[model samples]
Target: MKRIVVLLAFALTSCSYFEKQVPNEQELLQKELKAINWNQVDEYPSIAECEKLTDATQRKQCFFEFLSSTIQQKLDTDTLSVLYPELDTIEVKITVNPDATLVFEPQFPQDSTAYDKKKIDSILRVRLTDLPKINPAIKRGIPVKTQFILPVIIRGE
Candidate 1:
């Protein structure tokens, strides 16, 4: 019984020693363990940086320019199905009020689904304009609070 107790104590102590090599309070407090600054000091480039271009048309073009063609196609398909249904195109008019609130208009074909109008507008506002880089140009009216039309084809049928 004494030998067993000694063995168990030794095991517990060694286990702690090994665990001490892992992340503990000391490592967490050290400067070497600082959290990532994703913007300035990381390889993972932000979408805003990727989309930066000289003009609105070029900026829109940049949205399609991705390092991976597969991801681009996926984004295109997802965008089509999510933003357009029962229509081959969509016209988005985002008007910025003098008070800085946005007004969204999603114009669909006459035969399009009776999608929740406010919901559709909300989705565009949150997903497109609310992006960190997209807001400034939109607010400043560089692209201007105006109409933007893009084609969308229903996938697989």
Candidate 2:
């Protein structure tokens, strides 16, 4: 009986020696969050056509190309080129929201007095509203908001 009691006590005490410390939920979450890179996304925002692409770089290129082409087409229908004859290109800041909404803001140069900023902004807002459905970027399997600047060329012809 004494040997059995001693063995049981030793086993119980030794069990703790081999056991590892389990982190709490908050600590685990913090550690996981820290491991993630906030600036880079696992997947780029894409349209239905770009979804078929498997390569990350190709997919990103496809998305940007599609967006730029679509924006170019939309702006072509407007008189932005005619209104601002000297403005051959405009840098547009595109925001892809997690909810799949897109916002476009035209970035003008410091000497932007040659162009009507309000009218150009209104034209961009109106023209860009007809974009096709876009999937938000993915970070660790979860959709995330992303913003990038795209330079769109304007053809005066």
Candidate 3:
């Protein structure tokens, strides 16, 4: 009985010597990152004019509205209307670069004759260049490039 007790005590004492392994700095950092909420952004990127707004939702809305209106104003649909009076709609995607540069890409049409891309891009580039510098998107307070999908509706009336 005394031998069994000594063996059990020795086993229990040995267990204490086998300390739990500690994770490395990288592993700890990875665990912390995994615990973070990626879906939530503390603040959104906004134009200089909208920097004053504190609410994230309002700031985002203001940014989008301002961008859309500016693009709409720059669109010279007058000539296009004359060419294709029945032209209905054109889909385009705009990407905002980290440096606040604007890139417009018009969706290619299945029928070539149905639209003119080079002319549209030239006009777009000129207009975009003439406009003021835009603000880039923000993720975790860092500037990030973002894309905006827009539909350009062309109507004669």
Each prediction's whole-model lDDT (CA): 0.46, 0.92, 0.73
| For every candidate, C-alpha RMSD to the true structure in Å | 17.3, 2.3, 6.9
lDDT of 2 by residue, 21-72 (tens): 8889999999999998899999999999989988989999999999999999
Candidate 1 error regions (>4 Å): 1-60, 63-89, 95-103, 110-113, 135-146, 152-157
Score every model by TM-score: 0.31, 0.87, 0.68
TM-score of 1: 0.31
lDDT of 1 by residue, 1-157 (tens): 9999999999988986676445766777675446543223212122465555656555545543431232224335344465555544445554433333445566766785667666756555554543233332332222323223333333433
- Give the lowest summed-lDDT range of ten residues in model 2: 108-117
lDDT (C-alpha) at residue 108 in model 3? 64
Q: Tell me, by TM-score, which candidate is best.
A: 2
lDDT of 3 by residue, 56-157 (tens): 888988877776677666665456566667666666788878887778887766776766788767666776666666777767677777776777765565
Cα displacement (angstroms), candidate 2, residue 122, comes to 0.5
- The weakest ten consecutive residues by lDDT in model 3 span 72-81
lDDT comparing candidate 3 with the true structure: 0.73
Q: Which order, best to worst by lDDT? A: 2, 3, 1
